[model samples]
Target chain A: MKRRLLLVSNSTLHGEGYLQHCQQHIRDFFGEKVTRILFIPYALHDRDAYAKTARQKFQSLGYELDSIHEAPNPVDAVRKAQGIFIGGGNTFRLLKTLYDHNLVSEIKKRVLEDGVPYMGSSAGTNVSTVSICTTNDMPIVCPPTLTAIGLVPFNINPHYLDTDPNSRHMGETREQRIMQYHEEPDTPSVLGLREGSVLLVEGNKATLLGTTNACLFIRGKPATQHEPGADFSFLLTDTN
Target chain B: MKRRLLLVSNSTLHGEGYLQHCQQHIRDFFGEKVTRILFIPYALHDRDAYAKTARQKFQSLGYELDSIHEAPNPVDAVRKAQGIFIGGGNTFRLLKTLYDHNLVSEIKKRVLEDGVPYMGSSAGTNVSTVSICTTNDMPIVCPPTLTAIGLVPFNINPHYLDTDPNSRHMGETREQRIMQYHEEPDTPSVLGLREGSVLLVEGNKATLLGTTNACLFIRGKPATQHEPGADFSFLLTDTN
Candidate 1:
């Protein structure tokens, strides 16, 4: 089966230059083929700028943009939709809603089982896990029952980069954090996506996209580094 | 079976205190019960600060801290240790070493089967997971591989907190990054541990240490709210 999981980062969707780069990729991947886009407005509660930019991108591609608030059975919605575009924002809120609406199963089927196009930036991309353990949000509001859509098997930490020396107080670096996770045998694979990097998994092939670097940490194995134009399918694709 | 799973996080060990807070909790849970302490110095590359602090902590607790450099067999070292006190630093680096030494399986047994008093802080805590999806560090170095000790079934993103609205574009907020992982299904549960939080499981009783004011995102369920002193055994404990 063939599926398209495009990991758009907050770095791109929030900035014009990065956003343009992301848009160009989206067009490159799904141009003309995309018909309808489901924009997840959960990330930006009061802000519509992300959604606005996404709409503009779709318009540029000659595809229709949709802001789905309430669906009549979200599973049915995915079955009928062409593209599910999750905007970058707070992924926890989006996952909470998706869990409440019970839309994860269908989305999984469409994306992984049925070859649907699932494009998410930041939180939108982060919410598609068995759990959102790798997120950077605080617990201002914990839901009554927290669950995720579970589109991918491992965790995706987007916008991953090196530590800034200008910061005060020294502690574990980003590389250290992921290494500690690998110290255990049961830890899942970690994908550290830098700005402009994307983990593109289409069917059995996985590609790393962007100008920056991304780190893949798998359990019981050494972490592998990948730069732009690297074949990440070496890590992400399931070879059965 | 009493197991000790070491957890190293990127959080301030004492949540603002100078020394790591593992001492305060040690007397109650481990204390005189601890006999051997195997110091994993892989994370603290050139910086001996964390390792030195770990030795002090164990000694103060009246436990023997065995600091060894050249391990003929890392797996055997862990197998013979009475307790493992993994110090804080960078989890990514420590995990890489663990994978290289083929100690992930032994580490898991130490915690789940052998019942060792495995105590860790900061990055030490992060490595207990199968993956460090929720770590708070910069990607300064590429990990040798991806894999963790697998003490816990879930991927842990330590030092998790929301973004401060007052801040400008600096680092990617914890929430923004973890949400990307939540969007996956096959990924395990994510425990976003703020400083002083411990997901301790004794016997069949699993309780989350530290603050209960956490956001738990599981697959197929809505995001749930957790408060300090809440009964999480129902949600987090192993009933099986």
Candidate 2:
């Protein structure tokens, strides 16, 4: 597998500007090799505004960004693109638009076959995994299926949060929700990517990037946490 | 419609025991006429343990509770049920189990046609609405469809949370989510039921019960808050 992927937990940290926290990682990942990035703004509602935000951010990093929504031919755009970046919003709407535009396989081919560097944040990150089953977004719109572009073999729970002991809300915590996901048969292990974290995959080797720790939830096993710079390459071959 | 439903926002309050906050509402909804309550423990994984907890709670309220999982014939149990109560857990798991058992239409018949008293908490309350699209749950499992019991014309977002002004989390707030839900074509209005809140529908009249306020999110209109005693009967007839 010759895949170069950057799966970010979130685009913005608490008080920071858009893509401020992960600026260095993005810069180093793209470098001078990839000059232009085709941006998928389908996850968000306003494509123009989302594209503008991403363009301004990428411009500061010495790269050009083109939104797929404005392209005459989306599939052609993916085929000729040097890199891909999908920003985050509602996952269902994103997946549905991807299907509507018929760009899932094209994007997969560009990354997996052509070795195009791929970057996704939040919902964009969620759709890059095995399935969107572990996403925390609401099903505001029904997509044809929860099946996503399987750039990675395992599922990802992005923007993963720790249970607040002080919270009085009765909704299931992030940990409990992932535990429930494991109850379903044939489900893959989930990587809980906390905010400020990124899972960078270069070929078969995957490394955990950022300041916080990432959690791994395997079926019939207790959820365990791993610190930054941890090797998650086993996730590529281990589907269980 | 002769439906008598109690759709609670949550089973347990922040600091209270299970079903403790809505004890009086549950009791008055059934009264002396309905002595037995049929419990659906499918939302949770451990049927036996969920049944035991519900049995103990209803027993203290002077009603005998029988879990449907223990019934010789689950559909038959619904036919003879004097009242129905569904406990909350994962909404996806609950809907999938309901489809597996082919109990969607049967439960609908018991509630709408026979006027069997129905009560639901959290996920239970979500399934009782138009669809489980507004539920604040992870899609751990895939159901055949998102279409639910439709005991109410509109959808209900249980465990509806107000934005925490103090929190640093970047995840979408409850308001932004429902606004996204409204983006879909022909989607019904959504009622955001706060913790310690219950929406009681008796015959044609729907009353907001409990101490906290319920919010109505109508498409294109701003979200508005309603008091505890406010009549939501219009929600039934006005499906727009």
The candidate 1 chain A region of ten consecutive residues with least summed lDDT is A138-147
* Candidate closest to the true structure, highest lDDT: 2
Off by over 4 Å in 2: none
Cα lDDT tens digits for candidate 1, A145-228: 334566666777776656667644345556666665555445567787876677777766777886778877776667677788
lDDT tens digits by residue: candidate 1, B70-163: 4577788898887776666655566666777777788788778888877666667777766555555432233543456666566665665656
TM-scores of chain B, in order: 0.82, 0.98
In the range A71-162, model 2's lDDT, one tens digit per residue, is: 99998999899999999999989998998988998889889998999999999999999889999999988788889999988999999999
DockQ of each candidate relative to the true complex? 0.07, 0.79
TM-scores, each model vs. reference:
0.54, 0.97
Question: What TM-score between 0 and 1 does chain B of candidate 2 receive?
Answer: 0.98
